[model samples]
Target chain A: MNRIDKKEAKHLLKQMMQIRQFEDAIMDLMARNIAEGGSHLYAGEEACAVGAMAAIRPDDYITSTHRGHGHAIAKGGSLPELMAEILGKETGVCKGKGGSLHLADVSKGNLGANGIVGGSIGIAAGAGLSIQLRGTDQIVLCFFGDGATNTGLFHESLNMAGKWKLPVVFICENNLYGMSVSVERACAIKDLTKKAVPYNMPAECCNGMDVLAVKDMVTKYAAKARTGEGPALIVCDTYRYYGHSRSDPRVYRTKEEEKSWRDRDCIITFGRKMQEQNILTEKEVTDLEKEVTAELEAAIDFAIKSPDPKPEELYKDVYFESPSS
Target chain B: MREITYRQALNEALSEEMERDQRVFLMGEDIAVYGGAYGVTLNLMQKFGEERVRDTAISEAAIIGAGLGAAITGMRPVVEIMYIDFMGICLEQIGNQVAKIRYMFGGKTTVPLVIRTEGGAGRTLGAHHSQSLESWFLHVPGLKVVMPATPADAKGLLKSAIREDNPILFIEHKMLYNVKGPVPEGEYLLPIGKAEVKRPGKDATVIAYSRMLYFALEAAKRLAEEGIEVEVIDPRTLLPLDMETISESVRKTHRAIIVEEGTKTGGTGAEIGMQIIENCFDYLDAPVLRIAGADVPMPKSAVLEKLAIPDAERIYREIKTLVS
Candidate 1:
């Protein structure tokens, strides 16, 4: 854990900033009626995404959830295409058919983000099964929310991966709440790793606010997964700074709770830590923030200039036409 | 050509496809060591090994989602959901994930997977196991629905559904598994949406599929003796209903009767009948008559089950009246 070089920390910091700024811009666009939809923002949970993503190779697959922009960016998705996809432009990754909730970049090994709560859990298991069948060392990192842990698929997928020893690392981003339903109300235990115990899979919990802690935990399980040791679950203790979606006012949460989590913000803490450690200076952190904002602005401008899909595009892609058919 | 049971024909199709392509594999509950609940996948695991022939837990949603995941990743997975009635457990996986992945991905991926499950009530298996639910998949736009009535179709259409890039819901009837029919010797594939004229006649056209096709054919034979020739058409694929062959036969005969084993309310007959009105309304014969199961849950009682489903006599009587 102490071996994380200054360059590595900076790269992780940059990725986290990119995700934070992207969500910030999406909220701005929603306020302005430009990007016309609800977006599940990944603002406070930046360390969880950045750290887990840092442990895998570029070719390794990751199945994402509704709040997936952080995963997409951390997996090295192009900003212009992602922004255009959110804006529903033809130049987007899914040709504008998949808006913010359904972004996918197969070429980058992001299987896709799903709208269904536990939709991508089994998909991750399948991807891991594919990897094992193909005799490859690749692993599939599955991201799901706390509410999805209560679904049947979560248990099924874990048992499958545990029994078959499929190469998957299931990451549960237990952000304390699932659309106003507290994790305590939904799940029997506060520690989400308890769900993994029944499947005979190794389970661990990490401080999601700390990038190094998440990276270390994911790196440990990912190594075991790559070596054909089967799947493991890592429950990250994090919090969402914003409401679940655009329409939510978050009346279920208290202002004290919000301020408490915001006080330990990943970006602020990571930046200050690096500055104190001489990895980066105060001026350097400010410059990084300025660079992220400028890049986000350009992405917005590009999305605005991109062409909307034609009306005929509605009929396309309903079914894949094969040569034999 | 040699005669084989519908079950053997399906086994041949799966075996040939697994032999032909390295990427194709099979997964379901008890399909590997147990040879499936209905025995259609017998000896496949022994032939293909446990790697290709995967036996899953009683997890319907995971099986379907895994099939979709594998298919999107360039592997051909034929996922069996055991029975069509069990489709309700994983309908979200079917309707939300498996069917919609390719379209939602905007043609960037090709999902080639088949969900093979048996339907129809002949054995008194009660309400849950014996119901025919192929019509449920027909409503999902991104899915291709197929039900093969004959052994020849069982082999050919299964091959075609495996090769087709779209996600297909291949519904087989439990009653038709033992039905024998002649099959071709070598590898052959049938078009997914072509309807075959099983027995050609001119007085009235009968559009039927799966188990209902046999009843209609028997009724046609009885009607032929009564000087009323009933043309029987088997619409093997429901999603892409072969309207070309159906409408053509309707135009020729000027009368149409739809036969299905599913209950009457929201059955396949309603859609096919409405399409007949939409397409061949000007042909001017009569309103499309449908002989379908009674609109109620399949009862465990043998007599009640017999009374609920339409039989050869009911088809004969219905077609005779329509022709008159």
Candidate 2:
């Protein structure tokens, strides 16, 4: 689209690097038993989250998947609060209740991430409905994996959003595999964008490794959604550099295939582009990397120093205080 | 005070709430133009317009999820699931999402929504349509399960559920829709977890709610004729069971009999019986007895369905045996 200016390119590259650095810190903490439960890192699919999320305003809503750290960061999430949540500290965004999978920063218009696959599809449509009812021009950008297209909620939400002309953008990050199962084996159709045909919505696909391509595509669709043209679909052909979760060895894919995807790493490619365009100097790039690393390290220290919830806190936040019988 | 059918009382509550608050809206399948499958929401679409009175497709999960999302965004959405049997289709949204959103979000968001559905077996609607599944929602921690036995409660409690900040599973009985009772005129809100003693007595206590409350009250009258005066207590809300009122009654009567239309096994009655033993074990004069439907699917045949569910006769017999 030739729309990537110097400022936009720098922002996208910085956001992608921040996400990568944050996930790497989480991996290190998980190794040391500092963060409990699964961490679905968004290392390889950084461009999909940063580009798509950066296209929307702070008030525009976005529903995320289990692998949602990048989306949260791009949507203006607090580094300390997110790290604290993953570390199960009382100062977390969800007050230590929701770990990695259920991170939510409502103030940033993040409806929250879901542990269940495709669980947030219908919720995104609902947020769209709310915006429409409120007579706002804001659009909802719903993020999900390729595996979500196989769920009933995918079809139901798409049809409802289409019928109602709700202002929503359904962005599918087709990272090829859902856990160990490859998309080729699970899906009958090869092109994920074709699934949007039945819903009669505008559908497109882009090189997920290119931040400019993803941002341009999402921005175009999001504009249409804001103008009340109904929901649109954009499938980002990407791959996760890490395994689906911490426990996964990724035995399903060959090492050669993994190396091929890593060579096209979104962060490196975007950084190189920024440097070649004279948008950022090598020193600037190196300084941004150090900044992200230091930010992540400080967040980790804050999380470590934060106290665990008191025993009495177990009874709070339940809302329903039924008599203990 | 004015006498109205349970359906009219519920309609009044919805109408009054919608009128009082601009944030309150209604959404469900067949609720807008059709006035709901049970006619409880009749003429609402005309009053509220299509924007506020939304008629959804036959997508139960989406309806529930949308309502939950709307509620989180500061909208009071009252969703009707048509029948309790259809709750299975959307129970994931309720159990996994709606019930846990507030707590999982660390109480940052409030899901002020009500899921209203009718459940009971009287008409021959077959095994699927006719089933009382209130016990299913009682096991969920963050949900408030409410069942109104009288028109007054049906009106006041529905208003209260709409006003509550937590998600509520408001289970209305199909048989109680036509039951007439006096509802107060204006601004009546019943507390969510309070139990009311319908008829006070001393020999035994009959713990029941919704449609079964009527059967228990009738059985209490028959038991009175036989010199066994039974106290009838209606637990309006199940999740926050009014164990205090229940235990107080059990302490006075020293005997208890629970009546419900749901199956006997794993029924809420068993939970109440256990609570009675735990709290008032020293005051008990006899083992708590439960008169519940047989542990089987509701049959379509009239005769079989009648035998499958508990009735006034069954409650009377159970109370007589417990008091003896």
Candidate 3:
């Protein structure tokens, strides 16, 4: 095991805590009818996004899933833009056109999160192809749930990526459910990593609750892929604390089962480990929490106050026509 | 000037564009090895190799999804659907993703993609394969829909669509593929969204597109023997339609007849009829006439199929009523 320094560990812990607090606040806002529309919470999967994002450069691209707040935040997307997009404000990242499921920050190399299951896998492969064609050393990280692995698009994208030697890392966040259906029921083969073998790509499974473990494994794989060693698939055994969406009561899983994963909450595990190692003092952790709370509140306020898109602007930007024309 | 079939003209356009720009490539079902179902992409795989001229699986959504991704990332992709009816499997990707990407992204992206599909019901292919669905795309604002009726326009307009910085749905009539005409040999581009007057006359304006343009012209030739001079106009591109030219023709001719192979109810002709009434209603001598396919689905029987879609005889009948 490669040990990270105390400061690095503290910084990573702070980011994870920030993601947790932000998601919790979004849930609260949704309940209060402040954030309209359906929202998929990322409460229990912060470590997967934060750890994998920590391993990549800002210029390296990433395609995300609908449960994507953590991925967006870790990839350096502005909180104001994300919040505004959810609120359907004109100042949002996609200018109110793309809501929660379609958040994008191209400047930070974070491709948009897709509404369709397994939609972004092919997109990520194409992004990898773009990088290869441009002779750039950038790699694309594609994040999808275990449910998406069963999609034909997944196999198609994986096969193409393998054949083309595209530089991409396919990350599967196996929360063990595809919406209401269990992974066991949906997939014949439980282990998604094994599916990568037929494509001639390296595959690995990691402890999704352990941020450092995920970070270390991803760093190695990402470095290899960036150097043109081809694509890699990493299956992170994670869990979602809440149900699939805002409406799901989560009756599929037993209370004991939910509690078991909750006990290994990524944010709690990382914070406790950092405290035990004396990396972050209690006051520093509290200050970080307070800072994130204030930031989330400010973002919510900005989004609520922003005006809606003008009706006349609907026809604009449909194409990249010349301005003079 | 050079003489070539519409199919060869389209093939030459694809070949020339691919050679000129490395980012331009072609992908479709059986487009590579089989040279396209209509033979519009023949011998391209041999010239550009498999990497550029790709043959994808039978997944329509995946084929178009790959095209969307490639287009946004700086590649100009020309994707061919075996038939327009297959767009049902990939409409969300084309209508929602490819069409709205640039606008939804605040102009931060560009989908320079062209989806080439053949429509029209002369092949006796039945309801599943044959249908003219241009109105479905024209109803969407983000897409630019073009239908070239002649060999020369097929080559020039396709080249323009390839060079365009937006998503264009280039609809070709299956019946027009074998038709031969004079095409310029060198690099030439026809302006999109512009209508052309094929035969100028004074009595009535016959507006049409795709295979319907041939019928309209034939009807006009037949009407000329009866002392009815008809102006035949083809609104080559439907979405950004040249309303000015069409309205001007209507103003000169006084009478108007909109002809299309698609169903008359809610068809592209209906939209054109509405535009004429809105813009040039006062200049009209009579209510604009619409000659189109029957409201029912295209039939498999040869005689019934003939009755379903508009032809020269039907167009001539409609023109006679309007002129009388």
Candidate 4:
């Protein structure tokens, strides 16, 4: 059964709310020119990030993609630092060096967002190798887009993770498109799970809009991987509410498709499901939204008032201090 | 003192470093059972077992990417690319991720990764197999470039590089793997950014590294016989270049010449010679000359290959011209 206690379920709802609100606020900032840098919004894909992260332990690893604010939020990243980072402030998680596309909260097991397509796949394999060699049960949840599966790194890393049986889960956030090009135009076959066939990895496709379904499907694999059953690849059939970036006009998709996806907004549906199950009251769900709003408002205030990285910090942090450099 | 081949010296360094640090490991294509392309990692798998001395698939990006991943996660990984020419295939991982991660992360993490690869043309491997790609990594800020000319330096510098907290591109010459040189027994480590005056003299200062270091020494020996004495200084560590040593030598000799096996266009010699002009310009009696390889790819013909790279005769001739 796709079940969890009311507290954990409400926790998932809160994280989803944080991601949605944060992404929406970023769009507002970009419109007003408050945040000058580019941002890949993750508004509609909240369930996939929250549900998959809900299955893993806090100490476990996660390698995120360019659109990674949702993953960081679900992985226990501080909203203040995340906001500070996106605003290019010194108090940010990466000390302001990594902006939107490179936000990393390594202290919380978030390995940062990658700017390049398919960049984090191989790194996920390496982290898995680290766990395997060190005899740890920590599994790395690697996230990438449908477009990344076509890259050579995707093939090489998957073959490696399968051959070595490194404990990892290759999560495909298949929102049906790679930027302007739909997956139908880019991929030869529409079924994305078939890409894992040659690697001999156990694969599945789940309704990414449902947090319970995503959590149930991924929890099984995460448990199996911990028991030394090797790796698995999964597809989360989700959608991004915004364009590839802030400036992308999103002329590729039809309004009907957009409305259909928004009709099943993850937060609204999941909150309704919780209410029907008697897991929480409607008043409780409203309370969570109120808490999230206060949190995001505090994060915004902290980000706006924070100072920029000093000009002389340029030469710093190139290399960490070791015995020899 | 024990005389060993450069290949043997590198193997010893790997074995000792893995023995000393449990966090240290090796990963690459054909580096385990097949014993590395140049045999530098021979017998390491037997000594460290399959887990520590990992044999990877023929995926350059994964090999390097995995190394970076392991490094930032508190493990020390020494990964290998068979040929320096092949580094171009995975330059994104090396340049963008491994090199820039520490700086990009604001020093919150350390990437203790060492990339071992071989370059230079000698066996007529053509353009694809042999290339001096050290200058490419040198251009990346977060990377350290090391080229050890002798077997002793190779063993010592590889140890230092393995212990280094940053990404290091350790370039070896395919031609120098078999060359024998004296190496201290047991364990010894040389500092990464220091230069040594191989042969001191009064006429000119020849700055070289890798195989070019030997060419400069050969030229210095012959020029010594002609009373046109030349000093040879090897800048073993390329990134934190021992410019102080080179400038001090140039101040004494009043002449500087850079010999490199890579091409003259945008080569290491150009960078080093320009630095000499900028740092020690007033001390120079004449313009600093760079004796680099011909501006062409490594060809199939041995004669053409020989004519392309710098030799002792060419170094000696270039020095004679600069001094007179």
Candidate 5:
């Protein structure tokens, strides 16, 4: 893997901060009853999505999970469209039909945020197979939580990808609990990566709070997959800052445990590192924060001003242009 | 012109489509070396090789999901789910994903995938193996469901389904696989969503599809012997149903008898009956009659299974009742 430079490190830190702030604002909106529907906040797990995306090219594809705002942001989905989508506005991605659970930008190769657990695993494998058949060097990054590992589709897709040497990197953000059930209680194998070994694929575990560590591991595995070395699994052991969704108060874990993980927050840890290296001053970081906050505020305003989709428009787009229409 | 089995006609359609379009491929369990559960894809592996005529794992969800992914990314995938009953495993991917992708994506994406599966009872495969779930798919808004009753239709309709831009659920009756009929040698296409009047008459119309169409034809022959002329109609495509052809026949005949092999309650026959009543009620001389399978799970016993499903005798009795 190549060494990360000062400029690249700063950019990574900014992305992590952006995700943290965005999720915080979403939690606040949900609390105030302003944002309709629910949201799966990706606060503590930002490092995994940011680092993995940073390792891949813009053309590489990714299949996201229901907890997907971070992945969408990291994959370059516009913040305004994402905000509008959460608000169920017509101008949003998927024309607001998908809402928070299903956000897709196929043009950028973000397959879609899946609502079904482990549903996108096979889809990602198929995309990788397509890339292999087309003779393109593009790799597909399949993202899922610990809960998805138990699904039959996950094992089936992994086995096929292993046998066919499909270009894909399976990134498991093991956030300890799959909704309310802990991975230890649900899984027979405590080490999540060990599950990959049965399929004859190499596996590794990384401290997901450290973006640089995740970036380094993903870069190596993604390169191997691109060169037809077969699929690899990277288990990023992390924690979610908030409950599973807006409804969960997170009675599953101790408050002390949550605070301990929060102490090693990815955003603060990376920001402190930048300061120590003299790469960024406190004033510059504050300025970046201000800019990001204003940008998100404007995005909310855009979503509010966007007109609702017309009722007659509902019948349109049901089929690929009906024979007569 | 040539004569071929319905299974062979379907195989030729698949082989021709694969040869004509590089993006077209076939995937199913044992479909590669073993040819297929019913031998419809026999010798295709030798022609297209493993990469194109691929055999899949027993994961129905993965099979359909792979087809959905491949179709969206510029490929025409024909997936086989050996039995229609097995569709329950992949219903989410098929119903929620493949069927809704085009509409949900606002028509930006096209899923040109065909889910080929066999339905109906005859070989005593029983309960799970012998069920007609075409009505379940027909109820869905975005899916196009097709069932061919003859060799010519098996070839032409399958070709049309392969050329379609939406997800098509192509159903085949397990009993009709070996039935022989005339099929043109050259390339031919059948317009989907159109009904063909197999045997025209002016007394009463018998609407049927798949294996039931054969029963309807047999009933028509018996009715003709008694001098009570009957019109036999096959609405080959269930979703984009050919109401125009069916209503025209009902108008001329002044009565209708819908035949189906599925359970009578809420079956495809019910849908056809409702459509005829809604569209051609004023033209009908008698109330629409439906001759369908008994409202019970198909039995494993050969005698009980035969008694459960609709046959030629049942069709004849229903048509006689409607006309008398």
Candidate 6:
């Protein structure tokens, strides 16, 4: 049974709607060529980030992936700052230095989105080590794709985390595709969650399209990690409606395949479910949509008006104390 | 002041830093109970406990990645890589991650990490265990590389590397661990990126670091008896090469010879030679020379290994050819 109440479901629906609108605005920005580089969109995976992040504390650390805008927003990151960072503006979260793939809001406990595959897994373990040593209740959430499981670092990090009993939750947003390669061709194990069994770490598989199910599962597992149970791997079987990045046409997968995953869209399914259960009215849904659209528009306007970073600032932050200084 | 071995000096630095800051900790393979592969961190786990002194699995990439993660999130991690040759397995974490994180993050984050690993060949540990591959790290930007020579330098530079808010690769020579020198009792932090003149002379400048610095000093003494004054300079920090001190020494002698234990191709000697030509080209009276190891994998036999690397005799011979 889902632990979420009627009021909590409404809140989750609003947050999910917010992420959809934000990602849609990003697509518009990419179409106009205002956002450079390969921008990984997070349209279908909204419930995974929003659900998992909502269960953790604001101070708890999280290391994201290339498709990180949703995770950052769900972790209480500023919309204007994220948009500015994507647009490479001075007022961006990282002062325009990190750009899109490297977006980070450290003050809000987002360790930044990494460009490398399987890069942030070990970092999350390290952060958990810090919390354990300091004797704090803080937990760390590491979000990665199914592709990361193939790297040696993933095994190494999990082994260390299990041995030390570090307070970290390894959440694999198994979108089933590593770029153009499908999960069937990539991983030997059909059930990706079973990969964590070798490390003696507890593992689970949750319906990622159900926001309440994801939120309930993360809440229970995150509590276990906090109470000195060590690291746990939670696999959220989700999907991305768009291509791998801005450049990918996603020709590798068929229309039937994409439509099958699209039918279970978290936002549309959850919103209708709320109305059917009388948890929320149609009037309430319309109001939330209008409010979220305006919020996203304001964020876009703020980013567009922001100034570009100066060329001289390039050499400023390479090292904390450079040799010349 | 009290005299201590290079190994003891490193142990003292780790203990003092851990005592001073609760955030400071040590994590490596066999470091806690086994006292480290080289015993550089002997008795640390007993004093600091398992929480502060962590013993990790034999995973270099995990050690480096965890250290980076701990650093950016408020803790100060000093990881041990057992041997410098093992860096080949974990260079992606150091080069692509730690070295690029802060810069790629727009300087919003700082990785205050120190990786202490021993390198250089005198021991017949073969190619996998013995190597002077500091040059590989020197090629990377945003990384501070420090190769301390004597006991004092080992103690002081390590303390500095631990306190500094940057990722530093602290390379210790394998043979220098037992060598003793004067080291201050407590609280000493040597400034990085500064060169020290071990012996002042007039005819020529001998630039070296780590174990090579000792060879340069021995050669300088032998040359002094022969009425040839050779100045020996140890550029302790390599990445931020102390070009100012090096250029000043070059102007006085008008000649320079760099001695390094690594291969002649793309060694530290090559970098020093290029800098000498670029900055002190007008002051030069003769072409710059370098005494470096032969271009080959380290051999198992002691005789062949010695022939491959530079020694006191080779330094003396190289300086004789440059000044005579």
DockQ of 6: 0.58
What lDDT tens digits, residue by residue, belong to model 1 across residues A289-310?
8998899989889998999999
**Model 5 superposed RMSD (Cα):** 2.0
Q: Which candidate's lDDT is highest?
A: 1
Deviation in angstroms for B164 in model 6?
1.1
Candidate 6 local lDDT, B152-188, one digit each (tens): 9999999989988889999999999999999999989
Q: RMSD to native for every prediction? A: 1.2, 2.1, 2.7, 1.2, 2.0, 1.9
Provide the global lDDT of candidate 1 against the true structure. 0.91
Query: What TM-score would every model get versus the actual structure?
Result: 0.98, 0.98, 0.92, 0.98, 0.96, 0.97
In model 1, what is the error at residue B208, expressed in angstroms?
0.5
In the range A233-322, model 5's lDDT, one tens digit per residue, is: 999999999999989978889999999999999888877777777778887777777888887888888877887777876887667654
Q: Quality of candidate 5's docking, in CAPRI categories?
A: medium
The 10-residue segment of model 5 chain A with minimum total lDDT is: A316-325
Worst 10 residues of 5 chain B by lDDT: B101-110
Off by over 4 Å in 1: none
Pull out the clashing pairs in model 4.
none
DockQ of each: 0.73, 0.52, 0.44, 0.70, 0.51, 0.58
Candidate 3 DockQ vs. native = 0.44
Chain B structural similarity (TM-score) per candidate: 0.99, 0.99, 0.99, 0.99, 0.99, 0.99
3 against 6, candidate with superior TM-score:
6
lDDT of 4 by residue, A271-309 (tens): 999999999899999999999999999999999899999
Worst 10 residues of 6 chain A by lDDT: A316-325
Task: Give the lDDT of residue A189 in candidate 1.
Answer: 83
Look at candidate 2 and tell me the lDDT of residue A46.
92
Model 3's interface RMSD: 2.9
Model 6 chain B: lowest-lDDT 10 consecutive positions: B100-109
